[model samples]
Target: MDPEKVFHMTGGVGVTSYARNSSLQKKASDMVRHITTDTIQELFIKTTPKSIGVADLGCSSGPNTLTIIKDIVEAVEGSSHKILHPPPEFRVYLNDLPTNDFNSIFKALPEFYRELRQEKSGGSCIPSIFIGGYAGSFYGRLFPNNCLHFVYSSYSLHWLSRVPPALYDEKGGSINKGHVYISESSPPQVSQAYYKQFQEDFTLFLRSRSEELIVGGRMVLIFLGRRGPDHVDRGNCFFWELLSQSFAELIAKGEVEEEKLDSYDVHFYAPSKNEIEDEVRKEGSFGLDRLEMFQIESNNEDQKDDHAGKIISYGAEVARTVRAIQESMICHHFGEGILDHLFEHYGRLVDEEMGIEKIEPITFVIVLRKL
Candidate 1:
């Protein structure tokens, strides 16, 4: 399947929209704000280019999309002050697949600019921040040579450029039978297929960026990852496992065909720290600076005192987050008919699992310096 054509975060302002259900992503993005700030500061301390080029890859449309650019611009402004140099003109690019909802982001830009101007009126030295939307995959070159000083991606890159070919059998059956992603039950070959694809995609990503970024440019990547070298890390595997069970229910009710189960596999993988380091070493264009892992509760929100010893509505919050991430792909592949039922069942399965075992998702924040 073409991820560019099928993949996108849930759009619009509805409850299921990524705009509404992206607090987990917000928290994840905030976690790396310091790293992001320091990297941009280092850029100014080194290059002090007349025009600062920044790109946010996989910048899906939502409140979460422009917020990153805003923070980066703020970082640039603050960093320039410390370096005692006037901040350069900001040339910011927001990138995602061609099918992403750039219009929604464009529609929201007026308010973003207005707020930015209002906030800068006090003492904030506002550089000329020019924002543009670039529609394409980050796995390939998206900017001119040596044009971007810094790059940021959040909650993306776990998606492969495309589904692994090995997942398809000779008869066109998906080798990954009952699961959508890497799981303990997945066949050994299925696991290998995911690892190979991740390595290739990440290598290409680094190669492409190497050409676009100047020497000493920095990139901060935040995404789902495993703690160890295991391909079938259980950190977030249960989420997909329970999601698969939701489809199983539809199959039993005859609302969805069992054959579809054998043909569908999520084009996502959370690589381990070792896997990332190996890929970076092989690519040889960037030096791995810092690799840190953080564990966050399924829901980023604070738990209420009354919710002690209970799941604390984390299941619903998690279901909403997953829905925002996968709704478009699911609708494209499985048809819109099954969405409501599927998500309802998926939420129940998540709640059931929480009652049995609490799952904490692990996020890896990686910083790389251009060589």
Candidate 2:
């Protein structure tokens, strides 16, 4: 399945929409806001352009959409004011797949613009910030050569261009078998396939950014990653394993076919810090400035209440978050009939198994400067 065509956050303001379930992503974005501000300040200090170009790649439409732009503009204004320099006009690009809900972002623009005006009246030097939506994959070029001063991607870049090519054995049998992602039990070829795909896609990502970013331009990338080079890190692999166990439960009831579960895998992989650094080095376009990993709760806290049971609440939150991002792709692969049943089973598995399963998810925040 084509990820561009099939993959998108569940659209609109429904309960499962990314709009509702993206607090985790917003938190991840918050973790890197300082890096973004510091880098933008450095860029302005070194080479102040009349018009600053900034892009948020994989900017899925939701409450999270346009947030980084607000932060960027605020940072630019604050930096310029501190140095007694006039802030430049801002040209911001919000980019994602063609199938993304750009209209939601466009509809919210008026409020965003009004808020900026209000902030300006509150003593900020408001440069003209013009926002536009660019719909495309970040795996390829999206902006003009040397056009962007700062580029930010949060909670993206882990998605491969496609499912790993080696998912099927030479005999055309599914190699990954019951599991949906790489696990300790997966064959060596499965891990090799995932790593090879990550290497290729990350290299292309850096190369594309290198061509678009001017010399010394900056980027901050934040995404799910492993603590070490191990391909089967529990944090990276076990969440999916839990989901697979859910599928197995459904399979036992004959709610979903075993072959369907066996053959399907999400087109996503979380890399290790070393794996990311290696790809960046091989791409030869950007130099790493900062790389750090930080932990986040597997589920959002707002979903919890004194009334709700802990296990159910945790499972439900995780199910909602996963459903928001992966539902469309899963629907595409397995047909839409099974989504409710699938997530229900998935949630049950989480409630039953998660306490014992050592799943401590950590994310990587990387700041890189163009050569």
lDDT, candidates in the order shown: 0.84, 0.84
- lDDT tens per residue, model 2, 224-260: 9888878776685778888888788888988888988
- Which pairs clash in model 2? none
lDDT of the structure predicted as candidate 1: 0.84
Residue 308's lDDT within candidate 1 is 31
Where does candidate 1 stray beyond 4 Å?
A: 123-125, 299-312
- Name the weakest run of 10 consecutive residues (lDDT summed) in model 2: 299-308
Model 1 lDDT tens row, 1-371: 78878898887777688887788889888877888888788778788888988989999988887888888888777877877888789898999988888888999989998898899788776569888999998999899899989989998989899989999989888888877887788889988998899999999999999999989999999998877767654576667888888999999999888888778888888888889999999999999999999977553333522223443356667777888889888888789888888888887777777677676669999999999
Clashes of each: 0, 0
Task: Show the colliding residue pairs in model 1.
Answer: none
